[model samples]
Target: MSCLLEVTALCKTYRKQHGLFRQETIKALENISFQLHAGKTLAIVGETGSGKSTLAKVLVGIEQPDQGEIRLAGKVVTMTNYRKYNHVIRYLFQDAERALNPSQKIGDMLTDVLRFSTVLDNLQRQQKVLESLQQVGLMDEHIDFYPHMFSAGQQQRIALARALILDPKLLILDEALTVLDPTLRAQIVNLLLELQQQKGLAYLLISKNLRLVRHISDHCIVMQHGQVVESGPTEQLLTQPQHAHTRKLMGMS
Candidate 1:
């Protein structure tokens, strides 16, 4: 597979306020580097405040890093050119409800997404929308329902459909599976795997669920306090974690 996304010495920092007037800088990510290949899933595992979400935000152009560079498909990823990358990249937020509109019908929401698309005609757009919904296990009848009317898992499926509707080459899922029940999480994981196989899509999955990550990821990055303590092929890293932090994270002595 080709390298779809590359990060070189990526860094991010935030302002830390110690008191009313005192402030310091907190490093969110330090020298973080990785390459995400097409048609594979890379899982990022870390405790709270370890910068996994920050990395996802940076990749999706939601936040700018303090230093280093990111290249997507050989093009520099910048705020100015981020819109141009939308066709090839999509982000599935952890809060699917917040990501969706409450007032709009599902069909209309899908239709609105086409306002940014250049490939589909009216009929083609509707068909593509239906196809995307179907891919997520929703029926055509779901098209007329509002987001507030669906279950959490179904809402998440809608969000996934929205991301897939654009036929993105790279997807950043920031704790997307965290809110689901075990059965639903497993179902969605299977759906994502199938999609990856059929579409050759690359995924950057952020999660604290080691069990889920172990099942889904090709590679894993173990982070602690904004630093990557260990990273390797998922099986190797999970089975033979070398870092004390990684071993602790995996609950292995």
Candidate 2:
């Protein structure tokens, strides 16, 4: 598989207020670097505020990095040129319900993404929407329903559908599986694996779920205090972790 995404020394910081007049700078992501290949999964595991979410936001253009660059499909991308890459990188968040507008029909939500896509006509866009929905185990009838009309799993499936509509090369699964129950999570996991096989998607899975990480990731990276503590093949890292932080994550220390 080819390298689908690359990050080099990415850094981000925030000026957070400590009190009414005092302020402090927080290093959200520090010198982060990694590469992701097509049809692969990289798991990012850490406690809260580990910069996993910050990294995702940077990759998707929601936040700008303090330094470093991002490359997609071998092309340099920044905030200005990021829109060209939007169809290539999609983000599925933990809160599937909030990803949609309650008043909008599922069909409208799916089609709205095409407003930015110039290649597809009305008919092609509609077909693309239906095909994307089907890929996630949804149906045509779903397009007519509201966000409140589906179960959590089904709502997540719609979220996946929305992300897949543009046939992205990479997906930032930022705790996308956290909200579902065990059975539903397992089902979504299976669906994700199937989609990978079918579409050759590269996944950046950010989650605290060790079980899910072991099941779905080919590689794992442990993070703490905005820096990577350990990284290796998932099986090796999970079984014979090096860093104390990693061991702590695995409940070994």
Candidate 3:
């Protein structure tokens, strides 16, 4: 399979205030690198502040790297790159509430996205929207409800539906299932696998949930202090983690 995305020696730094006037440059991500293949999931696991979220932001063009390069589909990524990639790369944020608009009904929000992208006609767009909702196990009636009216899991499904509406090539899930129940998480995970088989969708899954990641991801990369410490086939790395950090992370005896 061809590489859908590649990050080479990526780095991000920020200045932090330590005192009234003193400040220091803190390296958030240092020389990070990875490749995501088409129709496969690559999970990046680490504790909070391991730069996983930063990496997701970079991938979705929300943050610029101070150094290194990111290539999407054989071309280098730049600020202007998002104009094209906006249709390809979408990020499912950790917070479902943040992902949805408080003022708009769910259906209207999705309808606007379809209208703005202009990918389908009004009738076709409505059909596709309803199909996406159904895929997430939501009904047409729920589409007219406000996001706050639904449970966290239901809101998450709506978010998933919105992301899938564009038929994106790469989905960057930033702790997306954190707010969901275990059973619901399993449902979404299975849905993702089904979608991958059906649509050839690729995923960059960022999560702290080890079991779910191991089950869903074909490739795995363990990050520490903003760099990948262990990476390989998910089964190999998880079953017999060579790195001490990886072993410690999974709590293997």
Best by TM-score: 2
User: Per-residue lDDT tens digits of candidate 1, residues 1-253?
Assistant: 5789999999999998898999998899999999999999999998888999999988888899989899988878888988888878899999899999999999889888976765678899889989989999999999999999999999999999999888899999999989999998888899999999999999999998999888989999998878999999999999889999888888875
Q: Please, what are the lDDT tens digits per residue for candidate 2 over residues 134-159?
A: 89998888989999999999999999
TM-score winner, 2 or 3: 2
Give the candidate number with the greatest lDDT. 2
Q: What would you estimate as the lDDT of candidate 3?
A: 0.88
| TM-score against truth, every candidate | 0.95, 0.97, 0.93
Candidate order by lDDT, highest to lowest? 2, 1, 3
| Higher-scoring candidate on TM-score, 1 or 2 | 2
List all candidate RMSDs to the true structure: 1.4, 1.0, 1.7
Better of 1 and 2 by lDDT: 2
Among residues 3 or more apart in sequence or in different chains, the pairs in candidate 1 whose N, CA or C atoms overlap within 3 Å are none
Pairs that clash in candidate 3: none
Model 1 worst lDDT window (10 residues): 111-120
Error of 1 at 52 (Å): 0.1
Residue pair clashes in candidate 2 = none
